[model samples]
Target: MRPDLRAHALHWHDKTRATQMEFGLWQVWEAGWVTAILRGASITILVGLVSMAAGLVIGIVCGLIKWARIFPLSLLVDAYTSLVRGVPELLIIYLLFFSSVEFVTKVVTAFGYAGVAESGYAFVIAVIAIGAISGAYSTEVVRGALGAIPNGHIEAARALGLSGGRIFRRIIAPQMLRIAVPGINNVWQTTIKDTALVSVVGLQELMRISFIGANSTRHPFIFYLIAAVVYLAITLVSQAGFDAIERLLRVRTRK
Candidate 1:
């Protein structure tokens, strides 16, 4: 911790119950646990945001490929979406955590990075694992959003002799995004919650830290409740932001 940030944290901790209670509501939980939680919360946020970005990319590319109906690839995509959505999400996380280590180990060794394959690669794999499941659902949302666009609009673009790429760029893409915002927010919310599952892989995310604290303090309810409240706060703020964006889109549509 930097001098300034450490000082600020101490000042904040002093203002709270850290000094007032020898043992907090959770009798065995350590002092200054709030700082630990803040650290974990930041990791959770980073993982969530990065995984959401990966989901969006996967969704957009796969959704467009599915829309194009390209034979074997389309069928494969259908199977992937179905499999991912059908399985329990925790199973998916477990599978990825177990399976990815060896593959990542090989890659890390090839790149001459030692000891990274265990810890750092686990984080990368967690993002990919969470994003993969989120992407499956996102694919359907994006496809549905694109389907909402009228066929006549594309036909008219063709009638005017616009190229296929140009048609998408000038016509389909913008409307797809505006219509897909709600679905995007839904995926975002789901991804954030799903990040908690990554804790099982030893990700040191908010949920993982809370679970450790709970075990050590024997205050499962208190620790879990803190984690729950943090998740709620994050989701609430995300909802507000998405809703504001939706309103802006609506206003633009009206104009």
Candidate 2:
């Protein structure tokens, strides 16, 4: 090719590349997507935190029942854990959402507030479904942690005349917590990502918002990339916090 023709081709290539890069970046900020994404992220975090907390409570109770081998209740807990863990999470969400919405709608309607049921039900269902799933995993975590406690410590406490509650408070509880932290953190990470599934029910979490933005802007790649980054940020921050807590617990155990 002639020198001038080559220069013209090179210029067009550069211009086209710049335009493509600009379009990609532009799509990310169009339509106040950043703000929308932030809002959705907040909801995701909120749902995750509340669900994890609920799951922890459920897990502790069921785990204790299982650990104590408490007859029929333990059997029920086993069934629950098995049922939840055995099923696909999305299937559980679908079953729970579709099955309970009618009852919830009736209950809400009886109180004279009718407008918010469908919208409100989505969040409730998200929490219930995710919490139930998280709890199943957490139950095993707690059960494992409980089993890890050396029987010798409990026996020593008993020999020292400590009551069951007292021994649990001073010896069993702390050790169990220390043993359980890493497992709980793992559950939390899974739980937060699981929030994405709730988007299917119209919960408007980060994933859902990203999907909407991608569709609206016709730039699925950029929007999804942003969603990935946001999820990564949340995970990194949560991991750091859990690591700190683990370190603190280790220091306390030493002292």
Candidate 3:
């Protein structure tokens, strides 16, 4: 064989070996590490679901404050929403993970509770970080939905002698939710993806487990690929669920 051809053959052989090695690693992962992957997946889902719910509550309150036209209160809520949304989600997670315990300690201390700082719960940190980031986006979504509600609806409610709270509860809140669902769905997906970032703080979330498996097995590509697939699966499932919800809401509204 020609020298060049021989060298080319050797190079291709080396590449093939690397590829096989990577594949072998993935095969091992598939064989036994599926449970760990599932555990991580559960954590990811829990964090996302909890954060989304907390975010919705925070967002709704902020959104209402914005709608209320109370200048100082509205400004405070606007500032909070802007600050949270403006910062990178990863940074927010990092700050929350590091400082949350201390902050909680101080609050507890102020209330005359001692030694609460020693109990640094990973789940709580993840929830707070995810919720804070999700709430920022939720606030805007809810605010836009509120704005989208027809002014005539409020006027009609007032014309019927409905009090402010009753008008909002009966007429405005439902419409706002209908309009907000699509936007909130986007935030929900974003929050799910954002949970991966929390893994950097030692959260045993899906990505973190993937990283551990990869490092332990010394097969970065294989484990990372699995992680990506899991994340994709999550996104797909969540998207389908949200679509169903949107459809249900639409039908209910139409009726």
Candidate 4:
């Protein structure tokens, strides 16, 4: 039978006893579920923020390589971005989760270290996997943004005897950011949603916690609803934050 139906069945039983039990369950849920959701939210936000930051750093480096017209290196970056974009995100997560420890152990052994890989290594692997996915998308976003900058500005900077680094820092970076804000916002949303996939690897983010709660309480509908609500709340708040950031940037640019 469906778990929701079963819950309804139990709730519909002898009035007084059912009422008492339901009230107690409600109280427990109010207290414990709130705590669980808060903890899960913290984990999810941390993972999203950290992964996005890591991805941005990696992506900028790769994007610069791709943009620099160093034929072989650009080709390699293109291949990497294409492979990541073409493959399933879940497959990436699984591969990283299962292979990370062995890879770390091998590297450590090669360096003459003796201890086994630590359990916390899974968290690092999760971050890498998610960050890699985000980086792939970010690379394209940054590359496109860089391309959108007018060629005349770069030539003018060059004419002014500005070095490459100074040209990029002073002339290219701000314009690229202005053009890339919307794309980066989309990447951030994608990263937030993608964090849910880490649940399959036993990371106790929001979805994983919801799965546990549903299984333990046998109230799948309730728990799933709660999870959906929590995710929606996160998305809404993040969207607002991004909007505020965009507005602030626009004001500063105007000034």
Better candidate by TM-score, 1 or 3: 3
- TM-score per prediction, in order, is 0.83, 0.90, 0.85, 0.83
How do the residues 1-255 of candidate 4 rate in per-residue lDDT, one tens digit apiece? 999998887777767676765764695477597688678778888899999999999788888888777778889889989999999999998887776666777776777777233444556766998999999999999999999999999999999999999998988998889888888999999998999888887677888888888787666666777778888888899889888888987987798
Question: For all the candidates, what are their Cα RMSDs to the real structure?
Answer: 10.0, 3.0, 4.1, 5.4
lDDT of 2 by residue, 15-102 (tens): 9978876887776676688999999999999999999999999999999999999999999999999999999999999999888777
Each model's total of backbone clashes: 0, 0, 0, 0
Predicted structure 3: clash tally: 0
Q: Roughly what TM-score does model 2 have, to 2 decimal places? A: 0.90
- The candidate maximizing lDDT is 2
What is each predicted model's overall lDDT from 0 to 1? Answer: 0.86, 0.92, 0.85, 0.83
Candidate rank order under TM-score: 2, 3, 1, 4
| Clash count, predicted structure 2 | 0
Sum up the clashes in candidate 1.
Answer: 0
How well does candidate 4 match the true structure in TM-score terms?
A: 0.83
lDDT for each residue of candidate 3 in 130-174, tens digit (9 for 90 to 100)? 898888889889889999999999999999999999998999988
